[model samples]
Target chain A: MPPPLKAVLADDEKSLCVHLKNLLQQAWPELQICAEARNGVEALEMIEKHHPDIAFLDIKMPGMSGMEVARRAADMCRIVFITAYDQFAVQAFENEAVDYLLKPVEPERLARTIQRLKERFEKRDLDPAPIQAVLKSLQGRLAAAAPPPYLKWIKVPDRQSLRLIAVEEICCFQAQDKYTVVQTEREEFLIRKPIKELVDELDPQTFWQIHRSTIVNAAWIDKISTSLTGSYVLTLKRRPGTFTVSRGYRDRFKSM
Target chain B: MMKTGNKLQTPCDSVRQKDFKPMSPTLRQHRKGLSWKDLGLTALFSTIIAALLTYVFQDESFWVYLIISQGIGLSICTLCRYSLALFNPQTSWGIVAVVATASIFGGMLGGTVGAWLSGIEMPIFLSKKIYTLRVLIMSLLFGSVIAYYFFSRERLSEIRGLLQEERIQRLTSEKHAVQSQLKMLQAQIEPHFLFNTLSNILSLLDSDAARGKTMLRDLTRYLRASLAESRSQWSTLGSEMELVGAYLNIFKIRMDERLQVHIEMDEALKEIPFSPMLIQPLVENAVIHGLDATIEGGTIHIRAEQENGLLRITVADTGQGIASVPSPGLGLANIRERLQALYGGRGRLIITENQPRGVKAVIEVPYATAP
Candidate 1:
């Protein structure tokens, strides 16, 4: 008979690790758990030491993520990601044909994963192409999972009292030397965050950077016309004056 | 002289005049009615028209012609403004129709008023046997051209405005739908507890039925309470505490002596309105992240209090220090989102290293009675 398969399990939850081991023992009695790790950093060390046939990993762990571990160790062993995210991002993993065990892994599902692993092992197949492709796609989706929620309201000093202005009400943000000016239809206020930071935090679809120092709300834009000087000017619906679209940002108004 | 057509006053002038008397003295300067501006402009135009007519006809009594011109100009300007300001003609065709009709009637009324004020009955002007007939025909043509030109210009901008307004409405609704969907997903009682807890209970059911039964009961209660709160997005601090009790009970059963939980809250402050499932996630973080990592396990303290007009909830675990604040998870992200959605700038979550050992998460929200 073929030698029993050796596997490593890595998860932050100690109770979960114990439960998973018990289930794995029941489902695959011949399987050997050579090492157990409670986080990603230890998982890598254990994988290198044991060189197990398979690695089960929790996607989120303390020092490093499972994705990072898989990237470093996919050549050494097959990877099965254990994830707690059932949000929109899990679909990416499923679409890429990578195996994943959802949090509170069910025995029935774990059995299916073991069955697949056994088939691959019996054939002596160690091709990592599919796994690598899945990892690449997953990297993109994981990066997209949470962009810290945008600024909802900004507190600015009004003439007498601080006025809380809704971010949506802002027509544009113009950068000064040290601070940025938040302009609405009626008045402007100074804020500490730079234009660069605002560009990263604001939803790109709603706000567009038309100049090096100005970010305008797309909804308030009234018209975009080429000036006699051959530069583009953006007029706003409620606010006076126009913003010039610099040569670098001319591509933004190409369709208009 | 025709530039005045673009600067014609609106029907709001009449409405503003009626309500002008009742406004507070302070607002009168900023919110002035347009009647004065229109009146002054009309008088100026009439004087110009009178001078032009006298220079052309060299009439014996220039004063009489000037008075007549003033009456006619005032009537025509007021009539045109009233007709044009009632409703925004959305379509190009509708704008044209309204402008044409208003122009013709305004010219006819002005001619009649002009003749009456000049001491000549309008019947002579309309009799079709005088040179005044030619002048009337000329006025009608000029008025129609000017009104149509002005309104067509206005229509171009109006169409653009409507399209933009429609787009804004559509985008706003789409944004609302997306936000509500995110809220639902964030507030959902996650199934992470389901399969694992059930599996654990399954193992215990055969060996330790009493413990398994207690765990099952607590899990069911926690799920039920969470599901109920998720539907409404809120609950009283008292009920939320009951939910937390059920939750910690399940974990306690799972870990046995490895987990210790201490919950404290004043009875008087229990009825204060609070967001549900918020503190429980932090408590779960304490147990799973802080205590689960330590070999000996440790205590998790859940405390809620009213301090300085704010509701403060703290989850402190005596296991590890801030070294193991698990990478950003959905639970932490959702907690931040729910707080922001509920309280704007007033709600805050603070994480700090507790003295002696472990991590503390403090959540403060505006204190208020149940809605």
Candidate 2:
């Protein structure tokens, strides 16, 4: 009775775009594929020209991504993300209140997405609250997805040859006078890096700030025992000395 | 030590003082045997009270009457304190009840004994009303004072214990929350590149089966190696190289021969330990930013060597060199952060221009062998 639902499909892969278009044609006979874009840039232009009712977009494209296209053309049409990410990674979309179809789109899953879109069109209800929430959640996920810098290796100076130490091998670091003493299971080395700076660089989960002068590897810790005076003593599995956990840093061992 | 004249006297009924010392429940119920200190303190206090009463009564045996009265009063006060301590009663009502009962009982017993000891022939109740009332008032004062002291002492200690327990509980929960949050963040590894590569492989499967199979094999190898290496915090240099090899295989499938990688690792350093997922990011950066930009693909040369007490790694690509020192992106920034965390100031990353063209990234860390 109503005019056919018009939609735009965008994907960098021509094969995938064609495949999705065929699937859509088979699932909903009344639907019209008004535009097909090979990339995000093309998709944006097509949306501006056609002003379609729905846009199916691949999340990652060559120059721009589906998320970017959604942001620019959000007011014009409803957006559905196409992604290759696993279910765990795609949980971000659920939080954003956005609809997403996983890669190698199945008929059953596509039908569900179509059903929801059809209901929204029939009701003529376009609420911006969920779209706003999705945008905020998308920003958060992007920030989290941005990988932070981490240490790869350490250069330790030995007697004759300069030794390369893996950061993970060092069991603990103790600050002495002006230098930090880096200890592994077998030997100890001195470095100019202060305990304070090392604390910032090391992974907080693996290397705990147990004492003011000591940053210990959680894996290397043998056991933590409370002394008669209520102070905590941390013993390392492969090392000789027992480190004293100061009152201020005792909270790190609160679970123990 | 009963006196000859006091033999005919109604034997002074002295209540046993129950002491509340920290002990096992079984031991707590059994009172500690009277000690020499207890006897001496009681004797001294009784003597003092007797001397004062003698001045007031002006009787021949006024000292004996005061001694009996003082002894009974001290015993009742001590008993009340012990009962209240054992029960751990919080209400003011409990204290009031203990004091009221102890005072009444002590007043009657002590007044009767003191009157008989003072050689009063008649019953004390039948004697002068003022004398009996004075004895009762004296007993009440001593009993209440000692009972009140014990009650307040217990209340103060209980409050202190509660405050200490509350502090420990709050700190423990806060630490647990922080540790779990760190774990959650660490577990969420960004798999953006991985999924994209997978999608490419899926498209290639139907179009070019042979290439898809090769890419799938490489992807499997990469996943297996990476997953195994990530289980532990450390990995060998040999294993890290293999992981890079696997990663390059997947990238080569997408880029074809456009991405050429040549790796030179010192045979001696193969046995040396390295952190997992370290140098791979640098190689990735070289490919994505450097080689991807050039018209024709460029070669990435990766070399590692042991210098004077330090290990040096260099990744150079033959692509268009940057005009200026550009700000570090996610990959370079990640490497910098990781290096800073591992070696503090000792760990260094130096970026420079290659001889002909492209950018060269050098990483240096202390050379230490695995135990």
Candidate 3:
């Protein structure tokens, strides 16, 4: 049998890193884990020092991002990125032909990535062209996937025709059973969905999650008020009045 | 004209009466319409006119001198009122005109009394001279008054036009600010959502490819809804809940038995409108900030009710609660700002600890039946 392929695992979560190392050993008994790193900077140093044939990188790290390390260590070894965030940066990984594993990494997916890496290594002339194409496709998909950032109006079903709702006129949203009720200064409507799914499509920075199921538009929070019960609540400048801040979310008021 | 004047006077008098009814210490300083600088200027002008009249009539009898003094005082008073009309057009001109006329009449009576007291015979020529001086003074006073009126009126119109222009500029800037914020919000939501969904897809590819395929279809639907409503300020409650359900379904696949969601809402509130994507972020926070930190997983509860004329929505989670790090996060901050912009002071959001050990958020908005 050919000599074991040497590798290093780099991730912030100690347990996850250990688990991945164990899986690598089990899957390819010949693969040896040369080193382990908790962050991107350490991963880079370890990769440079040991010069492992493969490196597993976690996308988010304390000091450096996984992409930066991958870019720098491109010539040294094969790269596999592990991420909790998948969609936004898929194209980035695709462009480099770097393998990526979404967190909580599964054994089957990890094995497939390893298999692909082994095949490329054996060929020696692994063209990055396919990866580049994938990246281009991902970019196109992303562009075509969502509405343009400048959208100003949303259409909701009214009596028979669609009613146009101006974004600036909405007040807040309330979750109903299997639906989300939208409250504006003028009217209300029931949409067929839950709150969690909508968040992926909405901007997190603009619409804040103040509670477990309540998201408020940042523009609407007039001032944060303290209640008689020693809890904090948000007072909006709009038509409807005060909203209470659950004790769990009180930490959000430390900056206020 | 009289009726109009009476109507105007009633409001003005009412305002003036209200202003003068109580002399609160805090409001005392602002009571006087004329500033110290204006009073000082008026006094200075009166003194100058008095001195000039005294010098011009030094050789004449006291009676003639008094008449000349009256003429000069009247002329000076007219100048002061005319100057005021030119400089400060917004204030009532009636008061200034009355004061100038009173001063002229007072000077004439004083001069006549002084002349009679001095016992100087008034020459017929002196009367002619007085009349000529009065004519000249009146002509000069009226001429300046008319000229000042038109000049100030023209200037006032120009200033009013400028103020209107400035107001338009301010409104435009405010609109731009709102639009930019909307754009930033759009950028933030899409990427974060996409990233999370893609991660889920990746995880599902191994064990349940069929489920993964369904998730993809759901994702496409979710994306389309998001894109369609991305720029909208508000959406129907029903639509928002649909989006939330889609998110839960996706998470249910990944979280399995660890995640549970319960929603409670009144049926009558189905048509209520609210900001788009409002509830989703809160649900997301429950997952990412609360449940994600724990291994045991948790349950999220959403409740909505109408109180008084307002709709109140609440989201509760049974998890580790908020992190002790004390950061509101960009997502929360954005929600607050958006609420403020949309509802001014009418909408509100609150976050608190749940009964057992989780986080609960409440959102309150005015209830309107139709758009």
The most accurate candidate by TM-score is 1
User: Residues B17-93, candidate 2, lDDT per residue (tens digit)?
Assistant: 12211111111121333447545654565556566666777654766656566656556545564554454333456
Stretches > 4 Å off in candidate 3: A1-57, A60-81, A84-256, B1-177, B180-189, B255-258, B293-297, B319-328
lDDT value, residue B107 of candidate 2 = 63
Q: Chain B TM-score for each model?
A: 0.51, 0.46, 0.55
TM for every model, in the order presented, reads: 0.54, 0.42, 0.44
> Which segments of model 2 are wrong by more than 4 Å?
A1-7, A11-39, A49-53, A60-65, A84-98, A118-133, A136-256, B1-204, B231-236, B251-273, B283-311, B316-347, B351-360, B366-371
Best model per lDDT: 1
Q: After superposition, how far is residue B168 of candidate 1 from its true place, in Å?
A: 12
TM-score-superior candidate, 1 or 3: 1
Of candidate 3 chain A, the 10-residue stretch with the lowest lDDT total is A145-154
Interface RMSD computed for candidate 1 is what?
A: 13.5
* Residue B174 C-alpha lDDT in model 3: 46
Error of 3 at B215 (Å): 1.3
Ranking by TM-score: 1, 3, 2
Per-residue C-alpha lDDT of model 1 across residues B1-371, encoded as one tens digit per residue = 11222212232233333333222111101112237866786677667766766677774266655665666556655665665455334334554565566555665676567667777766665774542543354355445544654566576655865675555544443344335434544544555556557755765665568977888998888887776665555578988889889888887865667789899999998888787678777777787678765656689998998888898998888876534232344256556556766786688776656656776778989888864
